[model samples]
Each structure stands twice: as C-alpha cells, then as structure tokens.
Target: MDLQAIRTFCRAVEAGNLTAAAKALHITKSVASRRCQSLEDGLGVKLLARNTKGVTPTDEGALFYERGIRILDDVEDAAQAVKHTSDNLVGTLRFTAPRSFADLKLGPPLMAFAQQHPGLKLEMNLTDERVDIIGGGFDLGLRIAPELSDTSLIARKICDIRHHVVASPAYLEAHGTPKTPEDLKDHNCVFYSNVEAAKQWRFGTGNNARAVRVTGQVTSNSGLMQLAAAVEGVAIATLPDFFLEDAVRDGKVIKLFEDVPRAPSYLYALYPERRLLPLKVRLFIDFMADWFAVPENHCEV
Candidate 1:
C-alpha cells in the first residue's frame, strides 16, 4: 500500500471532506478521491460514506484510521529523533497553560526557547478552563495543583508553588487582619471561581488544619482579577506565590497568618504517555525545569 494514499485517507477522515483534505495536502480533489478509492480497493472494503453535509468513516475505516494515526506518529518521531543530532528543531509546539502563569512566568523562558530554535513555531492557549490536551491536539500542558486527576498523562514536577492568604495593607487596616483562619468569616474575601478550593480556604496542615467557607463581594475566574481586587483593598485573596511575589515585595499586599502552613502544591509539566517521547517535548520539559530552578525566578514562601 502507498503511504501517501494512506495519509490522504487519514486526512480525509480528519477534514471530513475530500476537497478540504485535497486542499490541505496541496493536491487536486480528483487526486484525493483516487487515493481514497485505491486505499479502499486494496483493503477490499468501503472506507467512507459521503453525504451532503460531509463524509464520515465506516466502522472499518474508523479502526483503520486509528492505526494509520499511530503509524504516522511513529514515522514523525523517527524523523525527529534523527534530526535531534543536527540541533535543528522544526514544526509547531502546541501547548496550553493557565492564563495567570502564562502572563507572569512563561513569557520569558518560552520566548528564549523560541529564539534559540528559529525554525520552531509556538502555539499557546492560556485560559483558566481545563482543556482536553489529547482531544485538543496539544503537545504538552503546564498545570499547578496539589495532585493531578488524570492518571493517563505523565506529570513531572517542575517546582514547588506556595499559596498564601494576602490582602492590601489598606484593606487589612480597614477590615482588620485575621489572627486566625476562623476570623476570616467576618471579613469580605475575594474568591477565585476557577478553583474548587477557592470557595473554602484551607489553613495550616495535618490535625491543626481547617477549612473555612468565605464570602466575597467579587468572584472571578481570573487570578489576575482576584489579585487586582485584593490590591485595591477590595478583599482578602488566597493566591499563589508567583502571582503575589512582586506585590508582596513592593508592599502592595501583606501576607497574612505568617505561622499557618498552607497545603503543598507544585508546578507540573504534563504530557501524553508514549513509548518514545518526542525530542521537542522532552527538551521543553527539561528547559522549563532548569529555568524554574534559577534563584532569580524562584518564588520563595
């Protein structure tokens, strides 16, 4: 069987139309049609069914397409492995990360990486919403959590992230600082809607630890929004060290409950599990781990 024909068939399945597949492959529609027909004939099966809306693979075609994708991935991995020796990284690296991290921490290191490999293209989607990395065709993801829920993806801890309950000096002065976690109920708190834990702030650790359901005038999915509100004396916010480092240093915000031990969290680099990891993904993970280890970039608790 012709690999090109198999590729064309796979593209058709992805594109959902012969013309679109042909355009993507830079081939004529007739050529695309012939390739699909040839692939079907060689296998002695009907591969696709066409309709006014578009086209869909038959059951047999769907099974074949899955295998075809794996075959193509293997071929690309083999090529990338050989190309690694030349120190030339090409093609696109698509990834997703939290918007707050993307804005504060990812810009510098990722830009430096892109500059080093002029041939590489970086596509990043920064949002608070959790994305389906594999379904979205993302090469890798950066996440901050105490523990990852998806066991299918391989996660490597890049660095430890510390969380703190902080408020602007003015806000604390007006609302009065809480001597303990229980005192938080009397004060208005800024909640991050995206995080489940944000609804209930956890303080201390082990037997002494406690969870408090706090109320706030402002609730937002964006950490930056919560940080801004906290800075303006709106309310107290439980935020990560990376987001509040500059503010705390500048005296814009004051970290509260100095003796309280917050739960442990870490910055994680997550990617789909495979027998042979792609060189680009592996290199990126290593670079980020090293970058975060630098003292200047470290977020000390």
Candidate 2:
C-alpha cells in the first residue's frame, strides 16, 4: 500500500542479496529484511524465498514487481503533466481561421513556430465561419478584413492582402483585352460569392482614386475557385494577390487595368482581452509577421 515500502521491496528483489539490497536502499541489513517480511505479512503471501546463495521472488512477488514498474511510470508522467501546466508556453493553443488563409499564409509560419516550441501544442480549425473566440475557447483567430467592433476582443493587424484583377492570356486573346476599367462590362468575370455584389468589383485609379463597379458572370464562394476559373481561361477574376500571384508570374493569368488595383484588406490576429498574451502566442504572431513581411516571401514563394 505504501510506495516507500514497495520501492524498498523492489530494490531487494532486484539485488537478490539482503546485504546488497540494504546498501542499495540506504538502509541496514535488518531493516531491509524486515521491509520484505512486512510486505509479505501485509499481503498474506510468500513474496521471497531464502536459499544459501541469496533470495528470489515468489510468483506473487513477480506479479507485484511487474505491476509496480507500470505504476511508477504513471506516477512520473503525472508529475511531468503538472509541471507542463505551470509553464506559460506549454499547453494546447486552439485557433480558427478562414480556409484559404490557413492554407496559404498560416500553415508555414505555424509549422515553424511548432518546431521552435516543441513543448507547445497547437489546435488549428480551418473554416470561413465566424467563430466566437471566448465561447469557443479559442486562443486566437486569423481574421481577414474583419470589422473590429467587438469591445471584448482585441485585434493585431499582421499583414495586408492586396487585390488584383486577372484574366488568362487565352481569354484576353479571344475577347479583346480590357484597356481600362470601363471595358470590363463585356468580359466574362468570376466572383467570390461571400463578397456581396461581387459582380461589381471596386478599384481605385488615377490621382482621384475612384471606385469602378465591374460585372462578373461566374460566382463562387471559394477564392481558389475564382482563381481556377481565371487560370483556366474561363473568365477574368478579381482576387487577393495571395490567390493570383503565382498565376500572374507564370503567365497563366495576365493583369488588366494595372493602374487600378483594389483596396488592400488587412489580416489580423483576433483574441480575447488579456493583460499579457502567453509567450507561445506572442512568439507565433511575431513569426507570422516575419514570415509574411519579408519581400522574398511576397509573391515569389
């Protein structure tokens, strides 16, 4: 029943000789022998047999030893778990984000952060649905173009997502390319559905920085889908640079009305109010900034 008694008994069984076990346990020979005897008496079982050479375990002693090792292992794990709880940087960080942002901007930085802080755990839920940070027990959310009206939550702007109008070379060849924003009305356009009245894309041009309401034929809820349509020469699509940069570079999609790029949407880290964020979360946000803010990472990689 007592851990100390079990430990002493285990040592005696391992040593085989009472004198050796006594020295190993930092106790006298008589005390060591008495410990084994008391354990057997307490259990009403023969735990050890004394021969001329030394002592060996009975079947009952062998069973207890086997189970005892497992118990000790569990005890060690419990202690480690407690220690981990006390550490601020430890424990699982639950977060949510839009699917596209999670895949493109978040995954690489998060993976790097995980490697840097091996003890920390991260639970990422990728969804476009607006999640209640406090109610859902989330530590943070990577919100793109969010309106920070909630007084209870705080947001840190990490990066800006610039939008661009793109069309495939084939589509531009088939349909006379739009030389300016006014010419967009005649072309087939792809739109992201969540964006209300997406058929009407607003862009700023010239010193006045105006907004042009363009029309689109194909509409999709997913940014990737809009990008795919543009890539496949289906239609001209206006999308965030993050979504179209590769296609533009590879010549799959060509830019139109280069003078009038859409407004840049900010990417923010939203979290519940706290005096000081945990080091893990703080480090993660900083890593996200570093990974994204670098010029080399802009549209190339």
Candidate 3:
C-alpha cells in the first residue's frame, strides 16, 4: 500500500473536503483525489464518497483511517526518535485557539517560534467555539477556562488568567456602581454566551465565593464584542484581564471590585490522547509556557 495515499485519505477525512486537505498537504486537489482513488483501487474498496461539497469516508474508509492514522503517528515517532532536530521539523503544525486570546497574547510568541523553525509550517485556526481537536486533525489547542469538561484530551496548564469586572464610567454613573458581588445582580451585565450558565458570574474564591445571576442587554460569544458593549456603556462585562487592559488604560472602562478576587481561569495547552505526541507540538507547548512565564507578558487588571 502507498503511504502517501493513506495519508491523503486520512487528511481528507479530517478536513471534510479534498481542497482543504490538498492545501494542507501542499498538493493540488486533482493529485489528492488521485491518491485517494489509488488507495481505494489497491484495496478493492470504495474508500470515499465524493460530492461537489466535499468527501465523506465510507465505513471501510473510516475503519482503515482509524488504524492508518496510528500507524502514521508511530512511524513519525520512530523517525523522530532516531534523528530529532529542529531542522527535521518539516511539515504542517496545525492547531486551534480562541480568537481573542490568540490575537491578544499568542501573536508574538507564535511568530517568534515560526521564525525560529523555518522548516515548519504553522496552521492556526482561531475561533471562540470549542473545536473537536481529534476530528479536526489539529496537533494541539489553546484553551482558557476554569476547567475543561472534555477529559479525553491531555491538558497542560500553561498559566493563570485573571478575569475582571469592568464598566464604562457613564454606565456606572447612570446605573450606580456595583459595590459588592451581590450588587452585580441589580445592574445589567454583559455575558459571554459560549460559557455555560453565563448569566451566573462568579466572584471571589472558596468560602467567600458568590455566583451572581446577572441580567444583560448584550450577550455575545466574542470577548471583543463584550468589551465593546462595556466600553459603549451597554453593560458591565467581566472579561479576561488581557481583554480589559487597553480599555482600562485608555479610560474607556473602569475595573470594578478590586478588593474582591474573582476565581482565576487557566490557560491550557490541550492535545488528543495518543501513544506519542509529535515533537514539534510538544516543543511549541513548552515555548508557550516559557513565553507566558515572563512578567512583562502578563496583562494587569
């Protein structure tokens, strides 16, 4: 069996389309189609159901892919074990991350890493939604949360992310400032819709912790949009310290509850559970941890 054809089949399945798989593999769509066809012919089985929209794997294809991907991973691991070097990091390094966090904090370090490893191709997909890391064929993911619900993936805590409640001066002036955690319920608050129980905003930690059920005029999944609403005096927004830094510094918004400590969320590097993690992915995660360890990299609330 042709190894390249197997790889193409696997990539096509993950990508949900031949075009995307072809792009990732640095090959033409025609070539990708041909490879998959060759693999199917050799096996005497129809591996793919191709339509104008994309391609879907047949049951046989899925079964083959399940085993083939592991075989490929093991093969790569064996090769890396023999000759591990930065120069050998030749291939796409795909990952996903939250758009706001990646745009705000991950840019510099990611670019620096890319520059350091000229042979490696970095493919980063930024979205605020929780992505299927394994199904998406991503090598890793960056997530910010108090805790992840998905236990299937391996997680490494990279850093603590401080969250802050903030509002525009005008909003506070008109609606009256929330003097305590309880007071938040009396005022309109912006919500991050992506979070479960988004209306229940938590404050403090452990014994003194409070979950304030907040009413909101604006709710959005995007952190930037939430920040905007707060800046525009639509409502108070509790957002990551990084999201509030610029607005607070420019006096567009005022940070509230300075004395009350909010439960800190964490920045985590997540990857699918596998026998051997790719060396490039491991190194990148380490680089992220080292980068964020610097005091200057942290945003002040």
Task: List the candidates' TM-scores in order.
Answer: 0.78, 0.65, 0.79
Candidate 1 C-alpha lDDT tens digits along 87-178: 68988888899988888888999998888787878989898788766545577899998779978689999999899989998998887888
- For candidate 2, which ten residues in a row score worst on lDDT? 80-89
Clashes of 2: 0
How many residue pairs clash in each candidate at the backbone level?
A: 0, 0, 0
Ranking by TM-score: 3, 1, 2
The collision pairs in model 2 are none
What ranges in model 1 sit over 4 Å off?
A: 1-70, 206-209
Off by over 4 Å in 2: 1-88, 146-152, 205-207, 299-301
Report the Cα lDDT for residue 123, model 2: 87
Per lDDT, what order, best first?
A: 3, 1, 2
Model 3 residue runs over 4 Å out of place are: 1-70, 81-84
- Candidate 3 lDDT over 74-110, as tens digits, reads 8889887886686567777999999999898889999
Q: What is candidate 1's local distance difference test score? A: 0.84
